[model samples]
Target: MVTSVAPRVESLSSSGIQSIPKEYVRTQEELTSITNIFEEEKKAEGPQVPTIDLKDIDSEDKLVREKSREELKEAAVEWGVMHLVNHGIDDDLLERVKKAGEAFFNLPLEEKEKYANDQESGKIAGYGSKLANNASGQLEWEDYFFHLIFPEDKRDMSIWPKSPSDYIKATSEYAKLLRGLATKILSILSLGLGLDEGRLEKEVGGMEELLLQMKINYYPKCPQPELALGVEAHTDVSALTFILHNMVPGLQLFYQGKWVTAKCVPNSIIMHVGDTIEILSNGKYKSILHRGLVNKEKVRISWAVFCEPPKEKIILKPLPEVVSEAEPAIFPPRTFAQHIQHKLFRKTQDALVSK
Candidate 1:
């Protein structure tokens, strides 16, 4: 019902402006060339890595232990994506979130539209999908309930979905779970780098600068799966993300020059490295590019929680040890704020990829 027959480019405001050339916009066909570099799926259109149920895996056993933490780092540095089986978040909580997401999105547009983004009217933002043109491919069948996670209390919580009050409770619980996992993994990263937890905290900031958005993506059964993708190929901007997905599969990652399917295990979280680690690790680790593909037979759901640096933290220079006089900085230091703004509004794949 929210479908727009044709997408139009929405102009930006005069403030906080930068002009990107118009020709940079790539169509669905053009996206294939970049994707082909890493994907093995031979469909004329996209990858079809199968999704697996997490209940089948024993996440209680870690592939690498605390003593061999370097192995953990090596794995992340090499793979950038991992499957977490024993994460232990309650199943009731997941179901609650799903129900709340469905309840809110199913509301009449008149009610939902009250919170819609109003660039023309200057109201800024609220719940719902990005403008159709924000994505190069035909849009995903997902609907989301988004809110700011930084500066914690500074957000206008009143504008959030009032009907799904329990959504706040469920999502906040998930945020805490994700934060705990991020810290646990950070400790491993510290060990791998031969640094201590305290040092790792200081290198970034003692602050946890992350955006905890509960994206409730719904994939209605599609008749034509190849004509469009659930999400286009792209990289996540956070240092890492903890994802909880519905049993229905479609998540795929570009890896080792082949597209590998990320099998979804119920109750397990998917850990993915983002762009920041590639810089912090001195390119020892590269963030993986991923996309969502829909199915003709099922509906899908995913909640991706992004763990990042604080907006005020300037990741401009590498930790002195990581970059020596002989080595150059991987990329100029930029604030989490700038990274966030670009993620929210930049209109093209080239905008993120070229830089």
Candidate 2:
């Protein structure tokens, strides 16, 4: 005989609002019961993601720069991810950004609601606590806020936090620094592919249309961590993503058909190739599949900046330099919007059937 399990419900009390239902707080017992089902057996240790120094890439020595470029190519082709050090962002600035995020999240729930995401309107540039309404069993164990930074005109202040007055300033400064780093990295990647340094940048539409978006993710400590996933497995949908992970070990990526944890390194940033790059390279490079694991003890926080083509509708195709008669295009041309919409649809479908 089959048995039916009752769904769990949670409540949230905002400042003015009396009660909010279906917030999805799991109990320890419930969490433990599902742990065994999703747990994976530990695999033997293997190579970790490659680490590269930005200083070396900027060296005046031609041989030194070429060597760094080769290393980048190897990392991009083999792991689709790498750890970046000495990227030139101020350490104090990084700390300030993290502190700003923490302060906003710590605000009274009512205050945070002012920036709540409007799913019906298809705007994701605000705060979001729950993944889906009334979908108790299908929720992800995290809270996030997203916003666009570049092209200043595209910024939607309605969703930006006003309580922490410096939040905007801090994030903006950090993004500026990241933008510089991203441009350099893109040029290095082009060289690695045997193309003119400016070729890839030109194809994606120079700095004028370059898009940079920020996502602040907070993963609260879970009572039964093993049973819940902080984030489900998926590949990013942008050209590249730079992650400022707090001192936590919850990030993991699939490499060589095995899951490997991404350990945090001090004073460094983690870079992951996204779907756009894979298409642009004609599959010469890969978009890494990764996920977040929850911890029963520590709450993890991370800041991710996704760099991609502008919001304008432009079809992304494999560049001619990377595709030829000898090596045809592996991925067909598609607009960035189309690619993201499809990914979201698939994620929604998966959530609906998750339990």
Candidate 3:
């Protein structure tokens, strides 16, 4: 329920401010934790997020395909996030998608405001900046443009940028490709769980009913980079999130009591297993907590596509295949909308307690 009308970080960075606003500053403890991340990473021996090559995913050799699937499954269980190389999306298409997002973010503030979101009114799509609904009310040092791109009929083209003539066209093509990739990942994950290849996908939502939402995150350079985060730590609610980021590094994931910065590979897409998948898999798969950090140099941009279930569809419990007398359902039945409401309510209560 936090509605943001704050100034974009891009504008703030260029405003000649020596430091970020107090509201954007983190507490001393939070600062200390992140400041020593490098030292912690050095001492820690944890499973690093794996980079899996998907070029041979459809290989004629059955052993090669099986090995690829097992690697993906292990990454899902251990880290819940992984980078995919040669994911079949064309290099030209990838560049076009990045350029489209960059073009939109490069527009003047007023022009960008034409598509601003009204989160207060429950409209989440379009351009906006979110102020975290936490105890300190810290403002995330990022601006984003969000909208659903799949199931073409669900699109609201009015909010889509018009200034960049090819934005819609390029993004639409990218979405279709990502959707296929998502389906393939789900199939492999399902097989890994000893279920039919399509079991997990069907449990969440079939291809036609699934929701694919796109969010373009632009983390601008910050004056006080140590004190402010580009994004707050949290887990994604979607089933899967496929990301394409400009090679500048900032993404960090919590793993085995350490924060590990994900090393970016050019022309690669990173994928995350989200809460929905974790719930459906009966906690067998993880939904790791992650956040974005900002730096004094260079803007970091990422394009994330979330594969989700329709709001009204009920995730009635963990998949039958994953549950047994030994391992019962760990999560309660809830519609996607109810799950969102519960999370929002929890945030509100946490804020109140901290205050």
Candidate 4:
């Protein structure tokens, strides 16, 4: 995708999307001095979320669908993340989605406030700076698009901006496409786990009330990026996650007692197995924790689509077909939302992010 305003660091390294520095989070201690000053200015100023206005965003690539089922399964089991080459989303849709975000975020605070996420609606909307509080309870480095993705009820077309009508369509289309890809992955996982081909689809249908969500994160140009963060170290609340990232070096994954770069590939989607999935599998599958690091050099854009359970559904044990009585439940039965809120306020990386 061609853009006049993407980060400048895209050319800094050989890896287009796969080159975030390792241990990027822990390296910032002293530089944060300026942040305290900036924080004061932030307190005195009126709310002004940063945004880059664009007429549209577009790209032409199909590279996430070519993975073999075996490879998909292994990615879920081992890394808890993968690079998807083709799963059927167009460049224009992706660009427009990003453009819509740029425009929506650029809208006046009053305009952005009109459709704020209604607790009753279950659609977490509007804008939030530092939305995800980390284990330390400090504000997250970047803001995000936290809203419902499914359950026909949450699709309030009226609340979203129709003037940017094409934006809504693009997001809806993106959601559906991600759902299909998630289903495909789930199916492969079932087979990988030695279950009958249709086992998960049939039994897991109980989770239809579960809806997905999207985190459209745009990290603004930071003067002290290392001192700040785009996101914190936390596992997802859903069963699965598919992340599409452009060239930005902010994404990090927790692995083998250390943080590792996510090796983001252009036109590839990174798959993250979530806490619920790990629980359902009796800890067989992994749910890796990850953090996003903003840069002093440039702004970053990341699109993460979470594949979740139905709202009322409890993401507990997978199924009797997938496991035995000896295995037991990986997690205590609870609603996915409950699990997320419990983790949000809780401290410590190990506390809220596991089975």
Give the top-scoring candidate (TM-score): 3
> Model 4: per-residue lDDT, tens digit, 1-355?
4322212222222234333433223333323422332233224233211111111211222233223555566667777766666556676776777777667656655565566554333445644444223443345445555666665566656665654657678778778777766676677677777887555554444236446777778676554454555676678767788776656666666666655555435556677888877876767878888877665555677878777776555445656655667766656666666777667556556434542
Score candidate 2 by TM-score against the native. Answer: 0.84
Q: What's the lDDT for candidate 2? A: 0.75
Total backbone collisions for each predicted model: 6, 0, 0, 15
lDDT of candidate 3 over 72-144, digit per residue (tens): 8999999999999989999999999999999999999999999999877778899998856555577888999
* Candidate 1 TM-score, C-alpha based: 0.72
- When 1 and 3 are scored with lDDT, the better candidate is 3
- lDDT of every predicted structure (CA atoms): 0.59, 0.75, 0.86, 0.59
Candidate 4 RMSD computed on C-alpha atoms after optimal superposition onto the true structure: 12.3
- Candidate 4 residues lying further than 4 Å off, grouped into runs, are 1-67, 108-110, 118-123, 131-136, 202-207, 322-330, 345-355
Winner on TM-score between 1 and 4 is 1
Name the candidate, 3 or 4, with the larger TM-score value: 3
How much is the lDDT of residue 144 in candidate 2?
82
User: How many steric overlaps does candidate 1 have?
Assistant: 6
Model 2, span 218-276: residue lDDT tens: 88766556666677668998888999977777777878776777767788899998898
Q: Local error of candidate 3 at 84, Å?
A: 0.5
